[model samples]
Structure formats: C-alpha cells, structure tokens
Target: MVPSAIVTLAVLPLTPNGKLDRNALPAPELASTSGYAAPRGQTETILASIFADVLGLDRVGIHDDFFAIGGHSLLATQVVARAQQELNVQLALRALFEASTVAGLAARLNSSTEIKVSPLLPASRQQPLPLSHGQERLWFVEQLGLSNGGYNVSAAVRLTGKLDVDALSAALSEVVRRHESLRTRFAGRGDSAVQLIDPPWPVVLSPEAVATEDAARQRLVALMQQPFDLAQDRLLRVALLQLSPDMHVLALSIHHIVSDGWSMGVLVGEIETLYAAFCAGRPSPLPELPIQYADYAVWQRRWLEETALQRQLEYWTVQLAGAPGSIELATDRPRPAVPSFRGAVHRLTVDQACTA
Candidate 1:
C-alpha cells in the first residue's frame, strides 16, 4: 500500500564555500520500514523486484512511486529492459511515467503488453534530413559566424588494471554501428543542413604514452579544439592517452550539433557494456535500441502541427512577449557584426558556508 504520508524535508546541499551544489544532493531514500508495505501478490512481487533492482534499493512497496524515490528517465529505460527480459512483456517508457506505482504499472503491463520503438525515418542517403531541435538551434547560431569549437563537448576517463586497447576500439565500433547519431555528419546547402549518417568508420583507440598526466591533459585540450569538417567527416572522435602503463585517460570529443549531454551518457554506457562483452570474447550483449535520434526527429516534425504543440507555442509566445533580442553584457571590445565567440574560462571554488 502507498505510504500514508510523505516526509518532505527542504534541504539543499552546499559546497564548503556555501554555494548551492545542486549536483551534490543525494537521491531520495526509501521510506522507513514501518511505512512501507511489500507486494501483495505474484504480479506485484515480480514488478517490485524489477523496480528495486533498477532503483538500487533493497525493497520496494507496491504503492511506492518510481520517480518519487530517486527514479529518473534513464533508469526508467532500464526498468523497461528488465521487464522485457524477465516478464516477457513490453512496457512503454511513457507507461512507466504514467503508472508510477508498482501495482499501477503491473496492471498496465500484463503478458499481452509489448514494447515498441518509433519507426525509422523514411529517407534515402541522397535525400536531405532535418536536424534535431538541439542541433537546429546550434546550427543557426553557427551560421551567424560563431566558432565551431564552441559546440564541442568532451570528457576524459581514467583507465586502470588491464586496459585492452583492441577490445576498447572494437566496443566503440559496435556502439557507432548501433547508434546512427554517432556516425552522423551535417552537410549544409545554403541555410539548412542535411544530417548524413556515415557508414562504419572505426575509431583508432591506441593510447600514446605521455610523459606525465599533465601532458595528457594538454593533449586532451588540443584534441577538443581540433576543427571538424561537419560537411564531410564524422562529428565524434576518441583518443586514449597513456599517462603511465597502469594509468590511461580516454578522451571523447563530439560536436554539439549532432550530440547532447543525454546522448553522451548513452554513448559512454554503451561503450562500457560493449567493452566488457568484447573483453570476455562474447558478441555484443546490448539489445537493439527501439528508436534513434533520426526517428525522434521525424516524429517531432510529424507532430508539430498538433493542438498540444499549438497551445504550447501560444503559451510561450505570450510568456516571452516583447522580450529583448539580446542582453548587453559589459565588454571591453565593441560588438562585431556577428558574434566572434572569443570566449574564456575562469575557475573558482567557493566556500559553501559563505554561499548558503
């Protein structure tokens, strides 16, 4: 049964400098044992098991809400996958969001329930494709003469233990083959750009030995700035820098036009999964993704004319009525005809006590 009451504690974590460290906030913990009611029957028992596993909890109650107890969209995908494997039923991601409780979702996901991904976009290689919303915005700004490197996103991870270069490379290849967006490039014809999903071009994951970790950091910065030909080459690149025999740093830089934070998370997660399987000498264990970025773009464009979207657009229009075109930030240099994107970064660590 659902807990009779939810204890809401208003607490936001802060760094030592007192600035709100929103990222440092911990996940919502399970309710105390006194308040939780375990699954009542077989259906709920199974569903509860899956929920607890995905949520990293020892136990879950039939009435406990998925999102209320630290669940998120990505973890929701894991729940759907687990359900498909164990229960032989397909649960839509939306279904989980709708039926948040175990009993509610269990009722919706019986034996007949099946999961489905959006259909692929019906476009040939020769035809032009529209960019995703994020890409669309970034592309427009880039055409305004912004530097391309401004859109580059990157992350570096350290590798320890037995680092298998061959398997790591193979794993990235498999990941690229699996996600069309990773293999995608943009070709501009006038203002509009066509997204081109390139055929398999494997990454070279060999690590170059750097004298020290500091040297690796310098190289990573250089790699991040390397200009990409969005009209021709792939938008993603990877490098493995060997700081020492036992320590390696993996760097991946992707153009923001074809990627976002969520996509990067999927990329890294899939790489880890594929690498593990490859190192073990097994085939790719990752299941086929139900939908890709292209499919989503197609779906968005098709549904743009719906009443729901119209209402949203109208609301936003009124909300932003007479909004200024741009904010005049204090700068030493005069504003150019177009943004030069001559940007700089400064780092500071604030004390949490002073911030809060």
Candidate 2:
C-alpha cells in the first residue's frame, strides 16, 4: 500500500558507519495551510486541538486531512481516545478514519444517537474483581495447558547515540504503574476466575552486552520465546542489548492476556513520551488515566449482566445458525484436543512472470 504522505529531505541521515539511519529521519510535515478552514464552533474547535496535539503540530484547521499531515492508524486511536476523554462522548474508531477532518468528525459527533457511556472509574480492590470475558477464555486455555509462547507479542526498537538506562527503567516502571494490567495476576475463586491487581512496583531492566548483531538477534528471539506463567510471573518483559558504544536495542515482550496490537502502540507511545521527559530531568507530562484495566474488567462484568447480554447473544446466534462446527482439511497428522502452540515459518517464492 502507498504511504499516506511522502516527505522530501535534503539528505539521508546516516549512522556512524554510513548506513541509512531510518529512525533519525524526520516525519512528514503538517499539510500546508493555504486552504485551511478555521474551526467554526466549540465541538470543531476541541477536535482541532486534539488533532494538533496528537499529530505533534502547533495547530490544526477544521479542513486539514489527518493522514495527509502525518497521522496513522495508531495515532488515530490516540486521537479518538483523547476526544472521548475530553468530550465525554463515546466514539467508534471507524468514525475517525471515515471522517478524517475536524469539521467532518464534529458533524459525526452531533449526529450520533448513542447515550454517553458511563465513565470507567477505579473500583475497590478489597473485593476480588472478576476476570473480563476475554481474560476468562485465556485463563481457561492456560489451565488446559495449551498456552505457550504463541501468545507473546514481541517488538524491538534500535536506539542510536548515547542511551540513558536509568531513565528508561524509570519510564517503564511508570508505565506499569499507570496500566494495572501489566502488573496483574489471575487466580481461581472456586469455579470462577478473578484478577488481582498488584501494587505498582519498580521494574528492573535486564541488561546484556552482545559482540555481534547476529548474537543480539538470537538473544532477543530467545527472550521473546520465553513463556509467561499467568498465575505467577509478570505479564511484561523488557531487555536492553548493547551492540556497540553508540548503538543499542530495546527488546519488549508482553503476554496477549495483558496487551494487544493497539495496546502495544499505546504502550510504546507512552514510553517514548516518558523517556524523553526523564532524560531532560522533567517530570512526566502524561496525565493520569481515569481508569485502569482492572476498572474496565469490573465495568465489563457489570454491563454484561444487564439486558444487553441477551440481545447480543440472540443476534449472534441468529447470524451463525447454519455455520458448521469445524472445517475439514487434509493434514499430516490428526489435530490434538489441545494445541501445542508450536509454529514454523514457510517461505515460497513467486515468479515475476506470473504477474506479467
């Protein structure tokens, strides 16, 4: 797919050894304001400010295209989140993607019919909180012993130039402190499962030095492949690998139980913001979250108990009435009752002539 915008740079940034330094390249600038339309009303004004803040621009106009000005799907979620938090309105992520400009999104907000969703507030921890429906299924799979490294979501980012290890550690700890799910552990209360929120604690980074890039890659892969114990171990893992005096790699892994693709984007964004502030000897600028994952878990259980549950079940039941239980496919071996979660990569080369 084509990129949303293309930027022209005078020269490519290069590493000390003269290779392209991808991370050092600048993001595409905000769209030109020659045709800018000033925000007209309160709603549009608020939305414009949110767009600018999320895009890291000084100001955004009502007619400016979000994607044309360096916005992406990950940043779109942040925009929607900020709008919800500021406007106290429920919004679908698709709404922002479809109506990309401030004026268009404000019109959408005006036309929406849904009631304001009750805010997610922190609940008392004295009583055990029930596992979210999604977490319950994962807990079941863990109990069945079918879970493995398959659920681990791992990512690595290369850091160039002087690195601050202490600031990085403090940033990570602050993130864990903000998002309770990263520090949560699950347990069984009779036949039902519950989540326990651990008090925020310091997170220590595992530092290691590697002689070669290949060795660093191997070590990162091994660390990512390590399995997490839902009942015992913390759901997050982070390691810093030093490849050279001027270069390092930060490897991060989180269990799917506590994170997903979207959440990972948010996590990285927070760390980036926090790390910079700490390095500058400034306090964290991130605002405290109104609610934590544990609060969402409690809110979800309460909402599911209402009449909405029956309506949703009936709708889905009708939609899938005639669907088959399983699809039959030829296989080298019979499928086991429990999946081992082992996987392998297979590569196939396609001929250029096939397209022409």
Best by lDDT: 2
CA lDDT of every candidate = 0.78, 0.85
Worst 10 residues of 2 by lDDT: 111-120
Segments of candidate 2 deviating more than 4 angstroms: 1-118, 319-327, 330-332, 338-356
TM-score of model 2 (CA atoms): 0.64
For residues 253-294, could you state the per-residue lDDT of candidate 2 as single tens digits?
Answer: 998888998998999999999999999999999998888777
lDDT of 2: 0.85
How much does each candidate deviate from the true structure in C-alpha RMSD?
10.9, 10.9
- Residue-level lDDT of model 1, residues 161-208, one tens digit each, is 879999999998888888888888777867778688878778777779
Q: Which stretches of candidate 1 lie over 4 Å from their true place?
A: 1-127, 306-333, 338-356
